[model samples]
Target chain A: MNLLTDLIFDYTLRNIALGAAVLGIVSGMLGSFAVLRRQGLLGDTLAHAALPGICIAYLLTGSKSPLVLFLGAAISGWVATLVLLRIVRETRIKEDSALGVVLSVFFGVGIMLLTFILKHNDANQAGLDKFLFGQAATVTAEDVNTMTILGVFALLVVAVLYKEFKIMTFDPNFAASLGFNDRWLGVILTSLIVVAVVIGLRTVGVVLMSAMLVGPAVAARQWTNRLEAMVLLAGFFGALSGVAGALISVSEANLPTGPMVILSLTVIVIISLLFAPQRGILWDIKRFSKA
Target chain B: MEIVITGILISVACALLGTFLILRKMAMMSDAISHAILPGLVAGYFFAKGPDLFAGFLGALVAALVTVTLVEALKNTQRVGGESAIGIVFPAMFALGTFLVARFFENVHLDTDAVLFGNIEFVAFDRLFIGDVDFGPQSYYVAGALCLINLLFITVFYKELKLATFDAGLAATLGFSPFFIHYALMALVSVTSVGAFTSVGAVLVVALMIVPAAAAYLLTDKLPMMIGLAAGIGALSAVLGYGLALAIDSSVAGAIVSVAGAFFFAAMLFSPSHGLIAKARRIERQRVQIGLEALLVHLLNHEGEEGEAHESEMLHLSSELRWLPQFAQQIVGVAANRGLVMQLHGHLILTDNGRRQGQQLMVH
Candidate 1:
């Protein structure tokens, strides 16, 4: 008990937990759009694409400011997204293929660059390699503040454009006919997603970031049909998983916080996907039996 | 140039797999299998105690089969769709694999990066020799053999596969078991996925397996044509993308995928029967016809409400509804030339035959 109390008070532990909490909220909010748009894989692709941006930022600035790195990451992410869209538009490739292609190419380049940097540049390139698998323990107060501001900005954008987003996603042609500027709306939503992914990269890394984005929203979707409720519940689940995973990792020195957090979100999604009311597996089974 | 050759070989293999996956509506299963095989890979490494590629392949095959069997069982027993079952099982398995890796293999350089991203640059390092002449790249042989085998299998059993894909119930009634074919296809997908994992990685493999097939689907309705087109597109994209990537110093897989996307979009917008442009034109034509019909109906309703004989309007009409203003005007001009409607003091009047035709139009 004393050990647990002592661990909670540790600065690193607090920083990790707070940073994770902020990321969870951000991922949860943006993940709702991802799930609704049926672009759940987008987050994963964008996260992988962020790696090149971090490396570039480090190379250019020689400073490890989270803000600069994140901005660079966001730009790269948007570029990846644009490439994906271009591929889908200009070629005979399917959307999933485009996503996979963009994700791998960017990530592969990032890996190569990172290796080069490690060999040639400063050996103490602090916190950059951690972006691959993520090191939540290294998150600082500055990260928390940045994440909080971004999270608030993302949430405000979602709130202001909720109806437009709903119309555009559900019936894009009709929204276009109604002169809603659906193209612009899509751009805005995608940008927000890119930003959210960039911010969360510090906490979750490229590999498991998609899980954070998809898992909570998937879980929340099982419990409700209303978009608002699902988004709220998703946010709650995200925050809960983040905090719980952080606590677990802090309590146990061997466990990595990113994967633990991802696992927690995965568990929640599995539970909801299997046993939740209405859209759950059990519910589907019951309906099938009745039919 | 080496990357280009490797890309082409990989694309052909993926194109072959993509055909079946697209036909079966199991495109996303490739993605799930790619991720689910992680635990098997880790276990294989442990047993071999090193980077044993063959062991990894065997382990991945086992993992994929288990995944397919479990997903199938869940679907049968619980009535869950393929996607949902996939959603539940693969992630859990993946998490377990990740956990195990972190716990045991953290110090051994065994990580998700190697599994998910793969190291294509090292493909040349692993050489497969054919009796003194070294086969340029080892993976080329493996992937090439698999592709050839897949092509042969598909061709030999084309009739059975086609019948099953299009109408499973009919195939079952005809004494061909779709269940066997389904499992066979799944097994093939699993094997190919494992083989391809080393070259293209997990994520890009999914693209290779689905995009080309989907693009082919947009261009044709016939299965044979679709398969051929898919292979062609896949190969073309691979070459183009690899070249582009080399020139730009970017990712080969990304360029290839983008090229595939470009093809699909073009097909979606330009295809004759179902393309966006054709559909839009059809809608426009339909709206014009509907508007004309509504206008005629409205004029007819007004005539009936007035309780008038409507002799003048009736006389000017032909089998076409001439009471509607636009139709009336058009018909009058045509009738005058044909000597059916005669004009008196700017008022249109019909001859005996014209009046008969007008009455016929109303009755019909």
Candidate 2:
């Protein structure tokens, strides 16, 4: 009862909870496309690649405002995607190797820049490290609003291009043959995912942010074969974990919210993997035993 | 100097194993193991009541093995795709590690940021003393031992590793257990990760293991050459990275990885066998050759026809073959320069050589 009242009445708690929920919903919704397209690790790479952008944004604008940092993260992440695509297309390096290269190299540059900024300029660089592991407690009402706006914009695009995205996700060649500009559609989809990574950066940080993208979507997959249900269910699962993680982390001192949220998502994944009616492993075992 | 040596040693160890990992297409698995070992290191610390090295190493190795096993299990279930399985497991393990650190060791040296990028700057100060005798930095010995182990492992298992990597079915049929080779290689990767954990941190460990090997891969095809080149590249990155970090006053591991990335970029663009520039040139040459051949075939077919004069006129060439005006002009210029066709009075007349070449092309 006290916790519920605190969540409702407490300003910081309310902001953190709202911000986390928004991140969860956005990543969950877009991550479904990433997973279905088998680009599940792209989110991880994007999140890592966003660190350099955040540092550069600070260096360029000298502002800690979420909007500026979000823009910086989105732009750099988009560039990383372009680099990743070029490597795969132009070189013998496979997609997996390219992903590793981009993820690590971009992150290395980000770290180099971050350390340089720390050594040269001490002022206003305090909260910059928060993006590495994410501190939900620092989330403010304004940050929440920014996340909400971006999340909605991304989701709205997804909603508007729902059928096109579905076709592109499953059969991109077919989508292209149908004159859907599948390449552009793919770029749009990756851009939306970059948005999700940017929004989630403040709440889940970069390291564990991919889980927010992969877990809920994977969980949602076990329950349904349809894209629509999987996306909706993923959003719901993501929101639940986000709020739950926020509450649990806030209840205790020294508990990091990002990991807590990931832990919650992991639980959801295990449950979905074990108990979903048609696809559950237990059901398979039971059927096998009966036979 | 100690830090540079430590960096080179660790980079070599990782690159040696990384060559195989990249060949196996398990590059991201190294990334996974690197992150997943965090919880194990923390758990080892928790049980040991301090940051004991052996405890952490054991804990991390166990954690890495568990991560590999779990990913394989998940993949085997057919419920999750391999990439998705990897993407799911590592974060969960890392999150648990972060939770442990936040909960119990918040005030200790087990910082989250340090785990990501590492604190290699202080590695020089963290000397190994044996009975009052100073033995330089501890990381040097750790890295050196890992290098020796990886070198020996690769040497002993070269044939089996090669067969298993290139053709697992063949290895299996030959009574060699692919599963054993896979797990053994994974275990060494885990050990190397633990060894490099403190000096380069987790992600850079991946950067070291993958980036150098990937660059080497672009530059070579022979497995032995690839491994040597990977080690050489790894060492070069370490030296360059050390210099870069000293100049910029930043993270050494980050500098090293950035340097490694530069090397990969260079190999991608300039490698003679498989580089982008070389490939582009080859493709351009092929395109021009095809265009010239098509022009020959087109002209030969129109030769002696009722509309030969009209069809063979340079003015009508673009409309006749649907070629763009610029392309038609360039082809005509090349053909004229090569003495295959003559442009007299705006008419394209085939030369004796052109007739012979067109006849030859027609046969093919």
Candidate 3:
């Protein structure tokens, strides 16, 4: 009864829960594509890449507007993808090598830039490090609104392009023989990823954003084979973990949202991996005994 | 001095194991293992009551083993690719570790930043005292011991490692257990990574374990040479990166990675035999040689045609045969130099040797 009252009456709890739910849905939707395409670590790269963009945006605009900073982050995330692709295509370097290079180099630049800003005593830099680990209680209603609009837009694009995405992922040659333009499809897909990553970066921080992207999708994979089922299940799992994490963190003064959220996601994965009927560890054990 | 020594020790230890990791195409697993060890660190701290090296090693070793096993188990299920399995494992462990830190070890020096971007400069402060004698930074001794152990292990198991690395089936057939070697290698990698993390951080350890070996790979074909060159490259990157960080006033680990990246790109571009430039130059030379051979075959075919076709003039060759004038000139120049063809009133004529060589080329 008290929980129900807080859900409706406590503005801070309501805002945090709603915003986290939105972030979870967006990340889960896009994460399906990322994991299926075997670019699972791309989320990690983009999240880290967003830091310098946030810093540069803060320096240029002197505003803490989430919209402006997210734009900067999205742009840099796109640039990081471009560099990763170029390194793979033009050089003999492998995709993994390119990932490491971009992850470390861009993150180093961000660290250097952030340290520079702090040393200069910029008053605007107050609480900037919160982006490192994220504080859910601080999320405003305005941020929740922004998250809802962007999440819906990302989901709409995914729905509209579902056929193209399926064809492109399962068989690019067929898509290309149909003249569907693979590179353009890739750009669109990556942009969706960047949007998902940028917004979730606020709630999960740079380090844990990849978990948000990968964790739920992995859990969902144990339960289904169809893309539609996977996407829906992943979204459900993501929201469940997100809300659970928020509620858990709120129960304790010292607990943090990002880690708690991640822990919640991890629990779902373990449960799914261990007992999800056909694909579960318990199923394997049972089959082995019968055989 | 302690910092530099520690850097060198970490660099060499990582580079040694790195050679095998890169060769196995499991370089990124180092990244995975590095992040995944945090839970073990936290567990070790809580259970062992401090940052005990033995306890930390055991905790991290269990975590490392679990990480590899889970990744392989996921791969065996055929549901997730190797990369996806790796992507799913480390973050979970790292997040768990972070949560543990926030909940219990907040006031302690079990810092995530220190784990990620460890400071070599501060190693001097963590001295090992032996009966009132300062034995220098604790990390130096730990890292040096690890390097020695790595060297000795590789030396003792050199033949087995070589066979297993090059051909697992052959090694297994010959009574060397490839699975044993594989686990042994992972154990060394995990231990080395932890030792190195006190000075260079786990992320930079990945840089040391990969970039140096990859750079050396661009410069050598033999494993022995690759190992030697990789160690040298690792040491050089550490020293050079330290100087750079001092100059720039930034994180030394980051600087080390950048320097190692610099070495990788340099080797990629300019290695004498395996480099991109050398490959491009060889291809260019091959193209010209093929073009010259084609010109010879053409001249041989049109040996005596003085008809309206204007068979062998430079302009005729450029227009009729689609050869550029400069290319025709180059072919002609080569033919003339070899006494294979002669120019007669701007028309081409082949000598006996040229006709003989062309007919021999035709037969082949």
Off by over 4 Å in 3: A4-11, A51-68, A90-93, A120-123, A135-137, A140-156, A180-184, B51-54, B306-360
- For residues B229-267, write the lDDT of model 1, one tens digit per residue: 888888898787667656655555555666766666666
Docking class of 3: acceptable
i-RMS for every candidate (Å) is 5.4, 0.8, 2.3
- What is the C-alpha local distance difference test score of each model? 0.74, 0.92, 0.81
Superposed Cα deviation of residue B69, candidate 3 (Å)? 2.3
CAPRI-wise, candidate 1 is incorrect
Query: Over the stretch B100-189, how does candidate 3's per-residue lDDT look in tens digits?
Result: 888888788877778877777688898999999987789978888888999998899999999999999999999999889988988888
Native contacts recovered by candidate 3, as a share? Answer: 0.30
Task: Find the candidate with the highest lDDT and give its number.
Answer: 2
TM-scores of the models, in the order given: 0.71, 0.97, 0.89
For model 1, residues A1-291, the per-residue Cα lDDT tens digits are: 754665468788878887888788878877887777777777777887887888898889887887888887888898888877866675445566566556655765675566557666766785677766678888888887887888889889999999998888778899999999976898788888888887778887766677777778778888898888988998989998898888877675577788788788877876887888767788776888999
Any runs in candidate 1 off by more than 4 Å, and if so which? A2-8, A33-39, A45-64, A76-129, A162-190, A222-229, A250-254, A273-291, B1-7, B22-26, B68-91, B128-140, B163-183, B211-364
| Interface RMS for model 1 | 5.4
What tens digits encode model 2's per-residue C-alpha lDDT throughout A18-136?
98899989999999999998888999999999989999999999998889989999999999999999998889898899999999999999999998999999686898877666888
| Cα-based lDDT at residue A82, candidate 3 | 86
Query: Please, what are the lDDT tens digits per residue for candidate 2 over residues B1-364?
Result: 9889999999999999999999999999999999999999999999999999999999999999999999999999998888899999999999999999989897778887878888788898889999999988999899999999999999999999999999999999999999999999999999999889788898889999999999999999999999999999999999999999999889898899999999999999999999999999999878777778888888899898999888888768888778898988998888888999898777888899998999999998
